[model samples]
Target: MLKQFGCTKFATGEDFDTGELFVQFEHRGRMVSLIASSKGYAAAWLKENPYNNRRKGTKADHEAKALEKGGTAVYSILRDWVKGQVTAIEIGMLSFESAFLSHILLPSGKRVIEHVEEQKLLEGK
Candidate 1:
């Protein structure tokens, strides 16, 4: 997966470790690490930092209401996939702007993520 995104050498440039999914490579002499995570993980994070039910009197409040929802958990998951520069297996109808946000340099891909922890091994279980 890392190689798919031009991340040939490990960030640490050492042998792989199972406990962590971080991979790094130099991009113009700067090190960038791609943190791979599962949809479940992002969903758990969303569940942890829930929006406080405050007065809906501000624009931030309205934005939170729309962005911070149970359904957006899937968005958070896909965002991480984009962050990691994962390959695009399928892209049904997602918009290009939505797929590659300004924060992520890699384009987004179609993934069916359902767990906080990946059940498949790096070699693909």
Candidate 2:
């Protein structure tokens, strides 16, 4: 979807130990990076669909399965989201910047969301 929208560069990385993954792409001369953690998704999944002690071997086993499911789900969801957003951008319903503002990477290697979060925290002080 990104490539179809003039994204020329693409990269992906994962932390096997942490189940953290990131996808980066260059669009309209700006780099956008999005990160997701299988573990984090698993946690949320567990909350929505809690463990079934009667069907599982152990809690750990159930958690492992959830992590796998969440990992797959995250990619599928991300793909659909990117496709929809890109379509919206193409149709003039949304701008790329507004669609991916939080995922945009700055020269400092931090995401725009991180700066926005920091500013919000400072404002609360």
Report every candidate's CA lDDT. 0.40, 0.85
Shift of residue 3 alpha carbon in model 1, Å: 2.3
Q: Report the lDDT tens digits of candidate 2 across residue range 38-98.
A: 8888999889877775765878888888899878877777778888989998999999999
Q: In model 2, what are the clashing residue pairs, if there are any? A: none
Model 1 earns a TM-score of 0.22
Q: Residues 20-104, candidate 1, lDDT per residue (tens digit)? A: 2333454333344434433334356546654456644564664445444523444344446655443342243554334333322
For candidate 2, which ten residues in a row score worst on lDDT?
116-125
Q: State which candidate has the highest TM-score.
A: 2
Model 2, TM vs. native: 0.83
Per-residue lDDT for 15 in model 1? 22
Candidate 2: which stretches are off by over 4 Å?
121-125
User: Which residue runs of candidate 1 sit more than 4 Å off their true CA positions?
Assistant: 11-21, 34-125
Output the lDDT of residue 95, model 2.
Answer: 96
